[model samples]
Target: MTGATYDALVIGSGPNGLVAANLLADAGWSVLVLEAQPDAGGAVRSSHELADGFVHDTFSAFYPFARASPVMLGLDLERHGLTWSHPPAVQGHPFPDGSWALLHRDRGITADLAERAHPGDGEAWLRLCADWDAIGPALIDALLTPFPPVRGGLGVLTRLRHVGGVDFVRTLLSPALTMLDGRLGGEALRTLVAGNAGHADIPLDAAGSGMLGLLLTMMGQTVGFPAPQGGAGELSTAMVRRLESLGGEVRCDAEVVAVETHRGRATGVRLRSGERYAARRAVVADVGVEALYRHLLDPSDVPARVVRGLDRFEMDPATVKVDWALDGPIPWASAPEHAPGTLHLAASRAEMAGATAQVASGYVPAHPFMLAGQMTTADPTRSPAGTEAVWAYTHVPQQTRGDAAASGPGGTGGTVGGDWGPDDRERFADRMQARFEELAPGFGSLVRARRVLGPRELEQRNANLVGGAVGAGTSQLHQMLLFRPVPGQWGRAETGVAGLYLGSAAAHPGGGVHGAPGSNAARAALAHARVSALTALPRSVGRSVRGTLGRGTAGGGAS
Candidate 1:
């Protein structure tokens, strides 16, 4: 606990923490990962919470981001016992008329299906997918790296050309609905895009929302929605296995209470049990910006600009997730065969628009836009034979304080209190199930067991999911890249403190199971260390002289 030193310290065992630890360990650094949970994986872990043998991811499930993650890929988790599964279909948007707009791994088939629904849309889909294919790699490189994504950003511009670049810029700024309008023929295609975009707390009419749906849809088409063969926890197991192999250690049930710093430089961390670990190089925190600034570090050590930025550090919408151990698959009225991919079930585009508006204004969407994942459909290892591990999550206001005026479901005018008690959660969950029942008849009958996790419950599960804002923070214009967590170049780790780095989702490349934040943090830490080492020439010389004097006196230290 005392007088011990490690080359690097990671404050959480979430994906970000594990990734940062792995990266540092790869660099031949002695790293220690501390986790408050009895296990690792943060929100990305899975468990048999729903039923016996039916594995359900406790929080973050889908692996679209992880599938494309450079960090995950470089780590080669697959070689460490992580197997992936991809369903035939990537996504589906069904309607009441027993028709589905599905996206497949095969671009031609997906476009063809779209055309059948809306003839011209088939060509449009292919064009869009092709555009993504061309610039997608560059976009990923630009997005997943540190601020000032020069190469990736330029690659996109060069591919799009002048007029296309302007158009793409407009799309990034336009509301998702606006972008979908007149572009696609069928309601199914429109719903498909909206579903992808609305996965966030953004309103359909909200500016800067169009790109979200477009990017996700395209990613689904290209990389696809793949999950681990066993369960999400397997990803964690693989990561830990890899980390340990690099001489990195992860201590579960080790809660880091406060980061101990001296002279504006992080020295180490103190555990809740009063055990302290001294860090020789740097400390990385994989917690929210709010928690990091308000709790962990001493307020006196904080910079004023960061304090001001905290006011603008917005959290995304809260969520209420439901997981079920179904007796069988959901008996969908349309495209029951699409049980493998993600399903979007909302009444209609207009209804979804109204619902999202309500959520943006801090009220729950009465008919919440739901993203349902058929886990067993994609990976049979998730549940017992003939049964399904079904899970769905939808956005809601981060309303938890007290009652406020709110229009419930579909943004209907009504009062909605801010408080979210067990009763409130249950009521909303029941309504969501009922909504699903409308799309898939007998859905309730297949549910052998169910678990509901609301905003508070999510926070209890993982502090990084602060206020149940799962994606770490909002992806709005003001909270993005160069301005994330805090203003200036401060977003990429190097939290105002010299040796403390913010490796959490609140940092750059916010949220998802992607480990870019951690990757960036590791790079920053290494850079800082190199800079410090160069600056410590005189100090090192003094240390060498002091060691020479003490060599013989410190017996065991002398050869």
Candidate 2:
């Protein structure tokens, strides 16, 4: 059966796709969003499979980016039954000495904690915050918007002189470790910043790492890492609700096998079920770049340069995530003053760097650094009272060559094979659990149940997560901005095919829950539609003029 034609057809109902559909609908365009999965929201989903009463976010949990993104905020999701919830603190890093590095929502409390750790660090922390206060908003605006960020970049430049100008730029460009070493002597502040940098696959010692680390840290300081009041799915639900309210439609379990095109333009898509849906104006894809070019579109439709660019495209790394339904809160030897929603587990800075290096070198680190979330703590509605819904994820090599834990840094001669089979997965989960056990004694005892999702499982659940590489692609300097997805494109949402746009994480201003990629694509579609209509006006008039002249000549001859 053939599906009804819409002004635009959006592939994938992830946050990006939903955002695009909402924008198109706002412009009075008929938009339909298709999702291959059984449910909508993509990675922004949740389930109670681990425990009857516990709600666990399937993929991404804490959303500091969503709280800070103007694109997300402008949607007014709160009106669509979405409420933001923040834990007592934003992020925490527990040390072996029982000292904790916690980022509190209040800058004063965070500074006080830093001061307690190091004499001069309190003032240093505030100084950095003040500088961020001066330019962070503008910088973030520049980051979350389309490339060249003229308005936001100008906002940044106008405020630069007040915030160390060239030195500020240097600080943003510096390596994460180098920035921390130069600015603060306290391990607490350093740990917080460095651990946040781990959220990305960038190495701590790399050039572009500082900006990401600082961006997240500063965001936590200001907006805080918030979660939807119920679950991460609520965020997606809110987006879908908003889109539906705007007259957009979403259909799940509809797998698109191919994007049908003709005359170098996207026309519609064909589903595996032999159904064809026409898109009158545009087709926005919220899938990975590789999936769009390789699987969806025909080879003849893809530009040769893009085909070549795909060869150089590098995925970040594979991942392994574990979820637990804890009977009670994590019992810490020395509890943080304010419980944090998110925590970073690593013995030290060196160990954290070692783990990332191991992954980059195609080995699974023995002492993997983990980014964990206390979902119940972040949003009390996630689970029953007095219980916790916790989850953690660590990066691994896309194709494991060895296990570094057996002999790598901080390794205690543990042997876990690189195959990532059931045995290997269990062993690695045990290894990660041990890290928590170190900080919270008898932490394993509180687990009511546990579930693990490795690379294979992740890919099975979400095709965009190819090999469990969550960021869509590497967030390195070499693949960002104009170089993103491919060079010569200059971070545009438009694919080479007219009326097609890449609205996924693989596009510019990559990753995070920010809606820039989708918004960019939607705007591009609208712009092109206008241009096409305007360009067609003269031709339409010329034909009409010729017809009128012919009719007049015939009438005169007959007379």
Candidate 3:
């Protein structure tokens, strides 16, 4: 208290850390946040230098999760200079034949469009949307809250039980391609749904990939893929403003090198610059488990079993992103109804599946499945007059060394360039542009200026985005739920470490701009501090299961 030491110290000024700091500060505890970058938002910041009067979102353009996240809604960012703009239609998928499938905010209109493209698809679309409407809210709640989703999940189960669990699981587990094949047979309709599913790291053939398609499309129909007014960074700016309003302080250019310990409890942190800051309450880390357990903490300080378990951690596939300042809008033949929404360019569900397979083999597909957004169409503020800001991103396999000879069978028969450098990115970008041109004619002429970001660039910008994984880690079955980061330890943020906690996307409920991990970590730390403070008093304090200390801390350096 003498030197301005606070009750809690949060490492990393990403959404999670900012949310945690805000929560603790609201509870009357002084909070300090240390960030490595000059800015606060990890993957949510924006810049305007791409063009005059054009603000481009550096990463993460759409915010379906942000809109649906209970934490975000509760924060009421709108009142804090954050407004959302949802285009009439949420997304579209263009095909080689000039026709396209679009997802409109109005379900009936979208169904009509699907029906026009493929007979009987209207009913199938309606049925899918209806089923999603019944459980979508509950599912969103279940996903955003702490794992095992004690409350929201119960609500979901109750609803699902009334409808029958077998049917529920079957509906949720249906493959995107299978569903599209059975319902929407047209190539365009199939591409639309498959494109939404591919937004996550999961392949079209992955078991849970169907959920991404269904949930995102359904959410688009229900809420739309809205962007924060002005720019995506405005969302983070609002969170930062709110945190500062609550008396929380953020220190940029401060990277935590290690978490200091005493008597097996996290005592404080040492910055990369050799400055030390102690937390009387807790040290919440808004980074991936790899960095938290394998890099920051000493392996000797952590349990041997924990270190061994860390070896099993898997990262999502890396990505290649391209941003273009266009002289004019993409010229599509008989433009889709919702040109303002996202444009997915894949001919068929089979084609998308093949593309993922190709990427898994370390080869860039001849027809890569890409999700392209016309930011100027969605939010006019993103670009200048008579111009457009186009953003596109696609994924590739991780850990592919620059030697095709070293790659095993089923691998792409070409060496992946070192770290997906600028030259490689430009080549990939050209291929993508050509692919887009094939789907949407005159697409190439619109580009006035362009910039590309690859896996290495993404990692260098934000450590949380390891291997250019925007989601922090893969959303595969093995890496989800309590198994996230590691199994057997789910609820509390503590990693068996005394005061250290995992409050990043690598934790439960995984990535997006949601702040559930941070909120959960703050609550846990607050509870622990309260119990510890009470115990020090003269009177005896009754202990409860929630407040009871578990096993020893699982300490280790982060990956």
Candidate 4:
């Protein structure tokens, strides 16, 4: 492997890396993807280690973004043996009163449910869905494309006026709860939106929260939050298989320790085992922003602006995820007509916001707002018959200050240690379980086994999940779009090094299983190669002219 060379060397085997590799391979480039982990997928991997028969996604599960992404869709992964499965309902939020707020793929059904929950809300839901239908594709295209999305922007601009133009923009800029309040009447509908917004580390009252909330819920309504039919790993496996079929290669257990650069340009990468592989065209990195800049590349290779920007770079909050293998289906006190694959554990918009605020303020929320998944409900292949595989995750501060859930749940006090040690993780898991038990009376009895992955454990599994900051970096407005990874880069894949590109979640559009970053990076590399090829003739001609003149001068001197 040390003497090997390829047209492109992708420095991770996550979705983004694989996407980039596949695209390059399609372009007839010799692509090689090097993965540090024993397995290929980064956060996209799954395992059955938690229990005997239940399959669990180690990191990310549902992929509404992937379904809606042009890059993923264009891959035709279904042909490569990847299939998606969705629950009867896309998502659901249960209330203390036994009523539920559910988002179904069918707009009419979702609207009817909303209307039943609150008068006029049904109409409002339809209007919202209709508006999204008008602008959503262009909006998504604009988002997934590189900065200054000319074509996608034009598409969005053409449709903006019909969607209330500036007014719609203002609505997106407003806080999520505020937007929901103005648009819909019922708490149930608002709760559904707010809960989706809470998926990010953004505060419910923040400006960007509305856009995220709307984007996710609208995506659910359109595509549904679908997962791989067998497991999340299957998504990655299909990508790898597709890439391999395209004459690409993926090397596992190949940790890239340093990016080899020459004269301010990336030339290749060096592994931890002292092996080096060269990249003839470009080296695409699918690692974290900080890890790439601060660790992989040398200081001289990185731009001063990017290095200085790192000082202000903030990561999203750490997370604690709990996975459970259940003996039977989750015993909801009042199940919905259509079972939902995803569930939100929050009482209301206010409760969700308060919990988010608590985490932001360096304290664990007593009643944490959690996003949970019922894997078996979505795909029965995840577990044995009559059983379920479930997981829930919530945010925690990078550093612990105190526990705010003193008397909240699981009979634990507010003084659980903040270090996330064994004791701390157990206590927090108990708290999360208690939250689940609140909505489902017999939840504990159904749990056959459980696994708690704290920040450290998560980071250990995937270095890109720095401190368990799943989104790679904060999705806040301060660090998004032009400001993501750094301000000078203009949200492009180029890392300011001549032949290196950032294809990770840290790039523009932040996180999610979408392959935009990878596609963008691969396209950028291809564009650069085309430009280089186009200019080669002139450069060679000039060199020939110079050589002829030099030879003439030497001949005259000899005479």
Model 3: lDDT equals: 0.77
Which is the better candidate, 1 or 3, if ranked by TM-score? 1
In terms of lDDT, which candidate is stronger, 2 or 3?
2
What TM value does model 2 have?
A: 0.95
- For residue 374, model 2's alpha carbon misses the true position, in angstroms, by 1.1
Residue 467 local lDDT, model 4: 92
Q: What C-alpha lDDT, on a 0 to 100 scale, does residue 148 get in candidate 3?
A: 60
List runs of model 2 lying over 4 Å from the truth.
407-414, 539-559
lDDT of 2 by residue, 51-147 (tens): 8878999999988889888888889999999999999999999999998999999999999989988998999999999999999999989887777
Could you tell me which residue pairs clash in candidate 2?
366-405
User: RMSD, each candidate, Å?
Assistant: 6.5, 6.9, 4.5, 6.5
Task: Give me the overall lDDT of model 1.
Answer: 0.80
**How does each model score on TM-score?**
0.92, 0.95, 0.91, 0.95
State the weakest 10-residue window (summed lDDT) of model 1.
Answer: 550-559
lDDT of 4 by residue, 249-310 (tens): 99999999999999888999999999999999999999999899999999788899999999
Off by over 4 Å in 4: 407-410, 539-559
* Ranked candidates (lDDT, high to low): 4, 2, 1, 3
Q: Of models 2 and 3, which has the larger TM-score? A: 2
| Lowest summed lDDT window (length 10), candidate 4 | 550-559
* Model 4 TM-score, 2 decimals: 0.95
Model 4 residue 60 CA deviation in Å: 0.8
Clashing pairs in 1: 366-409, 402-418, 403-417, 403-418, 404-417, 406-414, 406-415, 406-416, 407-414
